[model samples]
Target: MKFFAGAAVLLLLFALAPFASVPAGHRGVMTTFGNPSDQVLSEGIHFRVPLAQKLNLVNVSIQKGEGEGDAASRDLQTVHTRIALNYHVKPEGAVSVFRDLGNEPGERIIIPAVQEAVKAVTARFTAEELIAKRTDVRDQIIAQLRERLARHAIVVDEFSIVNFNFSKSFNDAIEAKTTAEQLKLKAERDLQRIEVEAKQRVAQARAEAESLAIQRQQVTPELIRLREMENQRMAIDKWDGKLPNVAGGAVPFINVK
Candidate 1:
């Protein structure tokens, strides 16, 4: 009789084994006889058949992944880039995602999506444009990735380009081009300064010449004779009565009436 009682107890435990708890931020997929059911289980306690049904939890929270890959620019230069992606499996599509992509959707979907998106976007811009227009390139990549992954029920929260690398020869070429441009600008500024100085000198010479011409036009012989007579009259007024000195065979002030 005790043996039968123990067997009954074992059967009861087996029946209770299917009761399970789904944690927060997770959804459970129930598979019966190795076939996934369309109905999904939300967080909290649930019950299922012990041997015939299996429950797998799928995290519906946001997850992050990183990847690096090489691509070619429009200028045929090799560009290497690192990318960071934030994504999540749609809560409503958790069961479908799990059924289609299995447990790890990021590996099969997100990583390759990131790589292809980056390559496609990078190929549209030259190396210099890629550096200058980083935001545009990143936006293009994110948009493409979002569109592609949406079909698989993956939601892309955010995407970013972490780093970009070029070959040593390409870097050296860019540096050389920048240096040449700077030198050309400096030369242009110097030429402008020299031209301004030259113009200033020519203007100063023309002004001095005009001043001398104005003086020549105003002076006359009649004005010079009037100035000499005024000086003699002033001398005569200041002299005393005695004046008998003669020089150079002529008497001074002989015509003084």
Candidate 2:
């Protein structure tokens, strides 16, 4: 009787072996003898053939992948770029993703796609434009990645360029060019100020010369006679009505003429 009870328990265990649990944020792909099916199992207890069937869980939640590569710019400058991508498997396409790309889609598809997309986009811009028009470059790369990844049923939620590295010589050249432009601007301002001051000095000198010329023109013989009469009156006003007591008696002049 005990042996029969153990056998009954074994049969019950075998009966429950086909039912599998799929966790949240994941989908189950049913495969028959190593072949995937189009039917995607939603997150719950699922039923499959006991020995001939398998359940493959594909996480449909957002995942992050990173990639880096050295590429050449449009101007032939070498660029080392690193990027991050947030993506997920399409819930409806879990079967195809598992069948075609297997379990590691990030390694098989996402990283390679990122590298290729970055190379394709970077080739359209120079190294300087990569820094100046960084937004455009990043958008183009994201668009390219979305297009490339959609075919594999990998949806791109977000993409970003983490860092861009260039040659030391390029950086130095940029710095030197900036310094030279600043110095040139300063010299231009200084020249403008000097020219303005020189113009003011020339104008002042011309004004003083014009005033002197006008005063000389106003001086005539009548003006000179008037000045002499004025001086004689000033001398008489100061006299005490007495002549000098010298050997030669000198009298003060009273220009009556």
Please tell me which predicted candidate would have the highest TM-score against the true structure: 1
Residue-level lDDT tens digits of model 1 in 1-257: 99999999989877768688899999999888889989889999888898888888999999988889999999999999988889998888888888888878988888888888999999999999999999999999988988999998889999888999999999999999999999999999999999999999999999999999998898899988998999999998987978777667766656656
The list of candidate 2 runs beyond 4 A from truth reads 1-17, 202-257
Question: Counting only residues 3 or more apart in sequence or on different chains, how many pairs clash (N, Cα, C under 3 Å) in candidate 2?
Answer: 0
Q: Residue 176 deviation, candidate 2, in Å?
A: 1.5
Kindly provide the TM-score of model 2 when superposed on the true structure, using C-alpha atoms: 0.76
The residue-by-residue lDDT of candidate 2 on 63-88, one tens digit each, is 98777899999999999998888899
- Model 1: per-residue Cα lDDT at residue 57: 95
State residue 20's C-alpha deviation in candidate 2, in Å: 2.3
In model 2, the Cα lDDT at residue 100 comes to: 85
Q: Against the true structure, what is each candidate's TM-score?
A: 0.79, 0.76
